[model samples]
Target: MKFRFAMVCSSNQNRSMEAHFLLKRQGFDVSSYGTGTHVKLPGPSIREPNVYDFGTPYKQMFDELRRKDPELYKRNGILPMLKRNLSVKLAPQRWQDNAGDGSFDVVFTFEEKVFDMVIEDLHNRYQVLMKTVLVINLEVKDNHEEAAVGAKLTLDLCQKIEAAESWEESIDDIIVGFEKQHRRKLMYSISFY
Candidate 1:
């Protein structure tokens, strides 16, 4: 089976959306989803009850991207993965089970809160498998930096994974790298803050 990577971004609109497209562009099978449950069409989310409403212009941006970067998708091939299938459902109960489903070889959480929550749940339910999930705090200044950050992170991860002797060994190295970088960034942020 083709390797799968799931990226959970804070808001489904900008950062996560860009990450999804860029990964596909890079020839990796990736899927992205938002944190909150409620999804809307056309423009950002309205102030509807129980909705996260990230205000992502999914349709507009996607169309433009496809037109401008048609080769990015065409070269990759037809049906270049689907956003719907990769979109993860964030729920309390499914948290544990979802982490261990073996569907994803690697999982990344963009925000701190989601990282902490998902990491804890993954550890509790899948003690042995928890190491597979890498908690990355891509805490850049804003969404503008997300694309650059995501690309850099993906490159770093691919390097480590490629260097490893085996998939299992690479998985451990990737997680360690992610944690080390995350802590360093946190320290830098604390000093700046």
Candidate 2:
């Protein structure tokens, strides 16, 4: 069976979406979500407001930001990111709200807190189901540059996972091997975090 994957982060706008895009490009079934109360992003200025709700149209948010502060949005790469985010469906959703049908085979989280929240929520709502899911925490920073780095690591992990001949039997070994390989890669400043 093809593995179903989920990528999660605090806001779902940057890190998770980046990985979602890469994985989808690689022909995997994937979804992305946030574990925050609201979507938050950097604004044009210190005083400029930048908060949005889940499921808000990316174009709408982009347009508003562009109207409010075109320079800031453009300089910070928000415009292009927003343009890319527009294609993501079921995004910016809370983890608790998206425990959909227990279909995910694996989930990659960007931080320890998000990983904890997801595991706890899964155990509470789907105790038995949680046993079958592989949740890995890569502790990535929530930023444009960091998100790009994290996407590379996530893509590497997915490629490794996909190449395994027996997913169910070899998942543990795969994770162990991936982590070991990840540490070596990190030594070269690949920055999985």
Q: List the residue pairs that clash in candidate 2.
A: none
Model 2 superposed RMSD (Cα): 5.1
lDDT tens readout by residue for model 2, 43-69:
756675498988777778888888988
Q: Mind giving the per-residue lDDT tens digits that candidate 1 earns over 43-144?
A: 212452122234333343345446655665344321122232234212211223333564565555556775665555555563443334444455443334
Cα misplacement distance, residue 44 of candidate 2 (Å)? 3.8
Clashes of each: 1, 0
Candidate 2 ranges beyond 4 A from true positions: 45-49, 126-131, 184-193
What's the C-alpha lDDT at position 60 in model 2? 82
Prediction 2 TM-score vs. true: 0.85
Point to the candidate with the largest lDDT.
2
* Candidate 2 residue 56 C-alpha distance from true site, Å: 1.0
- Output the number of the TM-score-best candidate: 2
Per-candidate Cα lDDT values, in order, are 0.47, 0.76
